[model samples]
Target: MANDLSLNKEQILDAAEQALKRYGPDKTSVVDVARALQVSHGTLYRHFASKAALREAVTERWLRRSIAEPLAQATGLPQGGSAAERLRLWLDTLIAAKRAHAAEDPELFAMYAAVTMEAAEMIDAHIDGLILQMASIIEDGITAGELRPGRPETIARAIFIATSRFHHPAHAREWNAERTDRDYDSVWELILAGLALPTA
Candidate 1:
């Protein structure tokens, strides 16, 4: 008996993920998801209108829980620390999230590469959210006199672009390379110098 009287989108997404794992992205159908949840197709349709919509929801959910949420939690920014330290924590949190996702869900991580391209709009929003987060820290840095006065968004975007290799899914293969952390540290050194924040 399907006790889905209180079923929600999150529950639908959870079922969809299981279907995806079994069928991969290309083969996973709405029916598969509905079947997994032991619900009718109309029930699933109420949450996600189409397979594409379902994919986008899955992508958005992954980006939120895996990346954006963690970074926000790691640094509730615009706080008391020098911006450099906050940025370090923020960037480290990002790198750690990416690495963990790749390692923990290698199959999904690989499959997501294809879905992400199709979900460009969602990806853009996610990137924008992360940049805004960094911008908050940068704004605080300027106020604290640890960084040069400038547009926070522009600076945040630049830093994000510069450090994309660490967090970008395309670089998952290189994440485990022996030189990865050393390379990341080197980039951090350059970024720190540019920020004019005191390093200890």
Candidate 2:
């Protein structure tokens, strides 16, 4: 409700997130966000350029928050575990976090997907981030000699694509099944088996 001229991008994004949650992405407009911030629509545009941009910002923030903490924990895997173990742990943690997000707030999760449909560039960037994170972990594994010599980026993409059913929004319904964990373990073991060097 603070209409101060000093309203910043974070403040606008916070207000826009609230608006999007309340009205869903399709109905939430720049005017709605402005009202939430007690500012004119023009004031909001000064920060976001347009409603689509504002929605993308809000969606991006949400997606980033979902992974930021877990991603750090994943990357900071303890020194004790082998690279294969660490990689599996990191992937499991990410998949769990994504599943929890969808399960905890079905409506908001659906709304986020709706916002994404209108923001192809943002979606692409998000996927790129996921792949990059996977690649970083793969590089760590290869450096530690637990993984075979191969292109980290290529392996990362393969892992991410194979695990899509667990993390991707379109597969949310499938992610809810009780057998999801078992299904993941099977896929993860297969990936690790492929990545690990053959024993003498």
Top-TM-score candidate index? 2
Instruction: Please provide, for model 1 over 1-200, each residue's C-alpha lDDT reduced to its tens digit, 9 standing for 90 to 100.
Output: 25558788788888888888778888989988988888888888888889988888887899898888878876694466678889998998888877888898787787666666777878889999999999999898899888988899999999999998898888889889999999999999998788775546
Each candidate: what lDDT?
Answer: 0.85, 0.80
| lDDT per residue (tens digit) for residues 1-200 in model 2 | 67666788888888877777778777988988888888887777778887778767877888888775567667776767777776777787788887887877776788676766778888888877877777887888888777898999899889988988888788888876899989988998888889998877
Clashes of each: 0, 0
Evaluated against the true structure, the overall lDDT of model 1 is: 0.85
Residue-pair clashes, model 2: 0
Show where candidate 2 strays beyond 4 Å: none
Model 2 lDDT-worst window of ten:
68-77
